[model samples]
Target: MPRKVLVAYGTKNGSTAQIAQIVAEVLSKAGLTAEALPARSVTSVSSYDAVVVGSGLYAGRWHKDARRFVRRHRRSLAPRPIWLFSSGPLDASASERDIPPVPGVRRVMDNLEVTEHVTFGGCLEEGAEGRIARMIVRSGKGGDFRDFTAIEAWAAHIAEELAGPESR
Candidate 1:
């Protein structure tokens, strides 16, 4: 049977969710069974063979739902292969270079011994919630900086790792 992977994300403006969906699609295409769901919606992680958790960074912190999900599922997640991602750079920095996870995420990585973590560019369209988000959009600092190519490549790598050498 194919490995079941869950790509759970906490997103405020929906861009992170989109990134998670793309990652799930790539994993599925690579022969794993993958599903993307909101972190808050997931009641358990015990059923998945592997898990990919992602969150939209805000003020140097991950979304609240992502943080809560990790704290809630830490036990069930520790035994599984795990990957993590963050999206919240409103600039080209992520695409141009590697962006380290914020302190909070780093702590979680250490605790979970995550397989990998990545930072992708973020998007804040006009209708985004929050006064700051609207201000940024109106000030012309908001736009999609996500690199789909990089996102897909990372997901493919995860699939390859999960598939193992024997499968190759």
Candidate 2:
């Protein structure tokens, strides 16, 4: 059977979900069978050979459901290849340092062998921001900063890593 992978995400306003979809698409194009779904919708990862989990970063934290999903399935996930990502930071100024999983999240990642943890720029649509965020955006700092080229590059790299020697 072909190796199967799951690309699951926890999102608010759907930016991370879009990123997850693209990641799954890239992986599928690279020769792996991949499925992208919401984190809450995935009941188990037992049948997947690998998993890619992502969440929208909010106030230096991952969405609760995404964190819980990993915590809930830690045992089932331990033996699989796992990769993590976050979509946040509305400015080009956001750096790799801004992307590490939050404290509670780090504890979960510490328990497993995570292949990679990436932080990608996110989008903030008009009227989607809270009061403070609106102020920030009004200050001219907010925009759809997601870099599709970088995103696709990262996904392609993941595809190569998970595709194995035969596919390579």
lDDT score of residue 61 within candidate 1: 98
Q: Which ten residues in a row have the lowest lDDT in candidate 2?
A: 93-102
* Model 1 alpha-carbon drift over 4 Å, by segment: 165-168
TM-score of each: 0.96, 0.87
lDDT of 2 at 146: 81
Candidate 2 stretches with Cα past 4 Å from truth are 94-99, 129-139, 165-168
**Tens digit of per-residue lDDT, candidate 1, span 1-168:** 338999999999999999999999999999899999999999999889899999999999999999999999999999888899999999999999999999999999999989889999999998999999999999999999999999999999999898885331
The TM-score that candidate 1 achieves is: 0.96
Best of the candidates, lDDT? 1
Candidate 2 lDDT tens digits, 1-168: 237989989987788899999999988989889999999999999889889999988888888779888988999989888889888888874444455666766776788878878888988776764786677668877778787887888888988877666331
How displaced is residue 142 in candidate 2, in Å? Answer: 2.5
